[model samples]
Target chain A: MFFHKYKYGLLQTIRNKELTFWALGFTIILGTLFYAAFGNVYENDDIFEAIPVAVVENVGDDGFMQLLTELSQGEDKMLVVNKTDREKAEELLGNGDVEAIITVDESIALSINSTSDSISVSIVGSIVNEYNTKSALFEEIAKTNPEKLPQAIEAMNVNIDNVIKEHKLTDAPMNPYTDYFYNLIAMGILFGSTFGMTIAINSQGNLSAIAARKCVSPAKKSMSAIADILAAVTIVFACSVITILYVKYVLGVELGDRLGMYILTALFGSIMSVSLGYAVGSVGSIGEKAKGAILLTVTLLGGFLSGLMSHGMRQIVESKVPFINRVNPAAILTDAFFSLTVYPHYDRYIRSIIGMAVITVICTVAGIIMTRRKKYASL
Target chain B: MQAFNLAFKILKKNLGAVCMYFGIFFTMVILMTKFNPTDAFTTTKLTIAVRDLDNTTASQMLVEWIGENHDVAEADFDNEDEMLASLYYKEYDYAITIDKGFSEKLANGETDGLFTVSTSPVSYTTAFFDSQLSSFVSNVNCYVAGGFDVDEAVSKTAQSVTAAADINSLDGNEESPDAFEYYRFLGFVLVVIMISALSAVLMTMFKKEVLARTYCSTVSDTKYVMQVILACSVIALGIWLFIVAVSMVFDPQTVFSRTGVLIIINSFVYMIITVEISVVIALLVKNRSAVDMCSNVIGLGMGFLCGVFVPSFMMDESVLMVGKFLPAFWYNRALEIATSSYEQIYNAKDFATCIGVQLLFIVTLMAAILVVIRSKRQQKSL
Candidate 1:
């Protein structure tokens, strides 16, 4: 009887277009949208690129010209120098071809367009400042101590480029924008609460006609409810796996090497979401539409706080009111995925899994208590 | 007249859901504005973490200089995992550790292996910090070679590095950067709210039983359609006015400015385009869930593809090529022009062209809605 109920439960959920659309189709669509949106975020926005600079040499300054050439030659060059006449340099600055113009005169000066990227402008300003500072230091040394002039010049010439060694903390992909995709998958799984709500509505004798008939049968309500919830969990978990695979393979998102662990977290999250809907549905004899609305509010609002619409929102919440992240199921689920991708150790990932389990246990217990022994007055 | 009243009555029934969506989107706009306040020509100040292993005067001076310039925090040097987590979460933009022999090396005028830094992949902040550090170290070494002791060299280096260059901007005119950003994000809010609210009301009015009853009444088809259009216009105008009024309250200086007025007019035109599109969606999709799906797909799809959520400048050229066909693209393009600086060189012709294209979208969608409505009536008559 339990197997029979579970089979029909799966059939019923598959036939429900709305359930399947939110669970299976929405994530794929939103993930593709995210891919399209963040296509060049890392390459164009986050990474440092060489600043384009146009130089107009009014006076012959061999040292400054040599500096520009050296800076512009290497593969990881700092500047892309365009040595042009003043007329062409101004034109390049006006047309936004270069970030700024460096006119070599008695003193180095910078002219930038007002709309240039602030970081690029700052870098250009720093370059000009460094040159002026070095020139002043050399002049001061030559006048005050002629004996050490050559030694000072030699000391300045020692390549100070590699004085600081960079240590990479993780070999994982460091694209912060991938959090949006993780939140997208969590949203799809949370929408499975609707399936859980359907299960609750079907088990209560007062809510649905089919449930009323089942309540009069010899089958135990607890066994039948367990079978239905198990079926919902199975389907929701399957949809999540499909979405994870699609995001990894089809959309080519980097979700770390722990595919099995990701699937496992999804299963736990699916059970928690379904149980949440069941608890909400079992609260009263409120209509199914109202219950669905309640479930959606929980999922989307939780997602919003967890950085679904705006990236870095979760961090903001964590800084402002940490207790929210501790309770928000969406944040917990997203953190589980984030920890798996970012950290080598599993301590944070295990805590998130435990959080999911705690939510699942609380919701399942509450649902059972609500629907344990209820008699309809007029159904 | 009866059709207009009936349309609003149905809308009243769904007002709770509509307002809920409005509240969510309005909160999003407010949060976005708060988190991403834009300014013209402000230098970037990154948050950095430092661990000074050498307790020498030179190392302390270096740490002090970095602290004065940027937000600095002391890191737990023993815990690599904690530092890595902080970097991954962007709590620290870059982490630096002064080597134990940093002071000794500087005393000997050696410029190698003085410090170590950790950073996420592809961080511009790290590169900028590196340049600043290199400049500082080289100045100190030059002073030390000029026969000054370590303490005098540190003070001299500081004085030399403070000699700033003359920085000038070509264009003198300045506009409010925040106004433009707020309006750029308003495109997303307008699309989602207009479509969701309008579709819900229209779907109820276009139900088969409702249509049958309306057809049998004394009202002519043209009169009924005109009344419905009037109702939709009222709703759309109300939403636009509320949003615009909120902007006025938050930023009256920008909202009352000439460019701000133009942005408001641009949003007005885009609102009409959304209304027509929503009507078409209602005529095509039969059920409530179908309407919800269409609104999500269209709202979020366009929001992402266009410049609503992600800046178009950051998007790939191919993605923008596709976005050019969407109405929000033209809307955003107009907003960008209205807030143009010297780099973009504002042109009146370009701004007019953007608004003109949005008008074209409105006209095209209106025709589509008319065609769909006429076909549905013909099928009913057959």
Candidate 2:
């Protein structure tokens, strides 16, 4: 009987070409998107390449010219493009060609007339971040007396390690590629609920269909509701399976926890998501407006709590109104994934289970009530 | 006229469904608009620690000053080990420790005030914490001199001065972004979303028996096709305006002069492209589920891929090239440029290209759907 009902549902869904195309398209696009998004595409290193710089030696000093030559030919440096033209430098900013440009004047240190302190501050701050190197040999000589010159040379080289140490900060390693599985959780909920609601509404409303046939027979309303729920659950289950399999096998998304927890989240998530569809449609007055409002609200709120948007928004939300964070499904799913990555404890893990359960109960009850409501008109 | 008559019936019958969709759009508009665009660039989780062992009045005042400022709002551990542990664990941003001789050294006008602040030297956010330290220093320097003027020489040569960076940033020709630009984006998003939903609605309305029956009737096929487009447009435009009005409530800084006329014209062009996309979906798919499923994949997925979800600027180089091909991408790109510093660069030529691309997609997709409809799927119902 279950197999027969399943076949009927399949036949009913596939008869529509648009629906089939969407199913296939998501399997391709989202499959690829999730695959690509979940994949580790970027592996960042601290090496600089293609540094943009401009040179102008107005003082005509051999030492300054030598410094410029060394900068241009430095092996560790990536100055492939020497943008000496001011017009070209300004154009580069608009074209998104480079993050910044370093323009060197001949009297770079001494010439007060040509200086724009504001431009220097902005330019130098950016330069320090990218280059992470600083040298002022002449300034050091000008400040101190001439008598202790030989000894001071030895002392200056002694403090060279401090200059090297400043740049050394870039090397001490940690995972620079931030994990974004919270986004996956948000996608799952959005996909599951949208898919579930559509199928559930159609399955239930067309009582002349298989579900209605079951309702008229020895099968009770509860049994029929259960069957519909099961069908919806199957949809979410398939969706999660697709997500996990694609995310893990194809996309190489880190599931942090073992497959067991991933499976658990999917099941609980699917159940809640499917029930939400029934709850929405069962209200006897569920319109496209309400569904849209709920879906968008859930997507944004869920996506936000999962740290999908700007980090500031996420931090402010988490550190401030932590209570809302507790109820948010995106936060719960994120916390579950975060649990596997950050902590092995089940405290947050159990909270996800509890939250899914509450959503399940609420949605299930709403569905039951809607199914029990009398239809005033039929097509 | 027949299309309009039947369109009203379809809309009235699906009143519940229509209202739900509108509700969702309005809700999203409200949420997106309420967030302050000003604070989007502000850095997060900044913390400062003042380890004053002597605990004098001056020390307390310095500590209190840090406490009052929102920049150092989350200051944590008082002890060295505690602060270090938190810093390592990434709890606090940075730690500033003032030694016992800090007050005495500063009061004497001596340059030997030994204050050391430890930060994860690698963290890019260290500069943010360092800026707070500069503010503290300049304030103290002025306090000692019986005036608030920080010595100009020290200010110029200092490797890290907060006021210096602030002034530098101010000197640049920073454009003030109007809220209407964001609203225009919201308008584009709504147009696409509604189109997607309508595609699904069209597919679901299809039934095999109904299609076969329609084939046996005397109704002109082109007229029926026209009805679908007409109905979808009427409904979609309603959605577009409702979203616009709802979105506008959150942004009252309306530039309501002649520019409002320009905005209206842009909205008209955008709506035309939306109708075309909707028509393409209507003709391409016949099942309800397929309409929705395909619409989402095309609408939401492409919307994101085409740089709808996150701005295209933050996107990596490789994906950005692919994004340029999408119609929605051009729609957003044009919208962004029109409302940004690129107003001069985004001349009439580029604007024409963006509008041209969307129109081309609509025309091309519609033609393809028509060919498919006539050759194989003629026995259809709408």
Candidate 3:
């Protein structure tokens, strides 16, 4: 009887177009939109590129020109120098072609446009200051300590590139913007709570004619309810798997190499979402629409606080009200995925999984307690 | 008049959702204003974490120099994982560790392997910090070669590196930057609330059973449609007025300025465009869930693509090419022009072009709605 009910429950859920659309179709569409929206956001905006600068040589200082040539000569070159006249340089600056212009005269001077890139302008300013300061050091040394002038000049020519070593702690992809996609998947699974609400509404005898008939039937109500919830969880888990695969394969999002763990977390989160909805639905005899609204509020508000709309919102919430992260299912789910991708170990990921499990058990227990041995006053 | 009244009655039922959307908009605006108070051009100051292992005067001076320029947050440098987590969460921009022999290497004029740094992949701030650190070490090397001790060399390099170049601003106008951000984000809020609320009302009024009952009345079809359209316009106008009044309270200076007036006119035009889009969506979708789906997809899709969440300049050219077809893009473009800094002279022609494009979208969406409605009427006749 349990198997029969579970098979029929699966068929009923598949036939429900609204539930399927929210669970599967909406995720696919939103994922595609996210792909289109975040194109090259990290590569174009956050990464450093060579600063474009124009040089206006007033007195034709060989030393400054040599320095410019050296700085602009490598693959990881600092500056893309455009040697030109004052008028041409000013034109480049006005057109935003160059970040700043260097006037190589008695003293190095920089002229930058107000709308120039701040980082590029600062780099160029630092280069000029370094040059002027070194020039002053050399002049002072030549006058005060002529014996050490050669040594000082040689020291100034030392290659400073190897002075600092860049250490990478992990080989994981560090684009923070990818957190949006993780949150998107969590949101998709959280919407499955509506299906859970439907399960609760369908089992209550007062809610529908079919349910009222079932109440009078010989089948045990507990067995049927369990079968219905299991069926709903199966459907939601299937949809989440499809979304995770689509996000990974089609969208080409880097969700880490732990594909099995991701699917596992999605399955766990699916159960939690459906259980939450079941709990909310069983608590009150309110209209299904109101219960659905409550579920949506929980889902969207959780997503918002976990950085669905704004990147870094989760960090803000973590700093301001840490308890929210500890309780928010969406945050926990997203963190599970984030930890899987970023951390080298499974400690944080395990904690998030435990959080999902605790929520699921608590909600499932509350739902059972609410619906058990209840009699309608008038049905 | 009955159709119009019924449309409003349906809207009254959905007032709770509408108010929730408005509440969301207000919260977002307030949060944005509070968090991002300044949008003016300023030098970027990176948050760096440093652990000095050398304990030498030269290493201490280097750490202090970095502290002077950037925000150096204290961290347990012995733990690499905690620092990596900080960098991942963006709490600290870069983490640096001075090697044990940093001062000894510099004193010997050996510039290599003095410090180790960790950063997120492809970070611009890390590169900038690298340049500044290299320059500092080279300046110290120059003094070391000039016969100064390690301590004196470090001090001399510090004083010499402070000689900064002159920076000038060509910005012509000193308009408040916050006004631009407020209006720019308004594009997203407007699209969302207008579509969700207006579509809810129109969907109810255009439901098959309700429309069938309405057709049995004595009212003319064209007159009924016109009255419903007028009702939608009034609702849209009310939402617009409330939003504008809220803006006036938050930023009275921009609301009363000339640019503020232009921004208001621009937003009003965009509101009409959104209403027409909502009508088109309502006519196409079958149910409320479909309406919700369209609202999220269209609202968030446009918000991300049209420079509402991400600035226009930072987005790729290809992505922006697609955004150009959307009305929100033009709306943001106009806001950017109106509140632009002094360097880019605000052109009336450009602002007018943005408004003109939005008007074109209105006309196009209007035609689409008419086509959908006509097809529906034909189906009914069949």
Per-residue CA lDDT of model 3 for B285-370, tens digit only, reads 88887887788778878887888877777777787898998999999898888876424446899999999998899889888988
What is the alpha-carbon lDDT of model 3 when measured against the actual structure?
0.84
Residue-by-residue lDDT tens digits, candidate 1, B1-382: 9989988888887777678767766676677667664545655677999888898888888887777678896567688876776777688889898999887888899989998989987557776778888999998999889887777787777766655568777775254466676677767777767777788888887788887898899998789879988999899899889888888887788789887878898889988888888888888998888887888888888888887888776788888888899999899888888777223455789989999999999889988988997998799889
Best by TM-score: 1
How close to the true structure is residue B161 of candidate 3, measured as C-alpha lDDT? 77
For model 3, the stretches where C-alpha displacement exceeds 4 angstroms are: A140-146, A284-286, A375-378, B1-8, B37-39, B172-176, B206-226, B341-345
Question: What is the alpha-carbon RMSD of candidate 3 to the true structure?
Answer: 2.8
Residue B8 accuracy (lDDT) in model 1 = 84
- For model 2 the local lDDT of residue B307 reads 54
2 versus 3: better DockQ goes to: 3
Candidate 2 has what TM-score? 0.63
Check candidate 1 and list the clashing pairs: none
User: Can you give the lDDT of residue A60 in candidate 3?
Assistant: 72
Q: Is the docking of candidate 1 incorrect, acceptable, medium or high quality?
A: medium
| Candidate 2 CAPRI assessment class | incorrect
Docking class of 3: medium
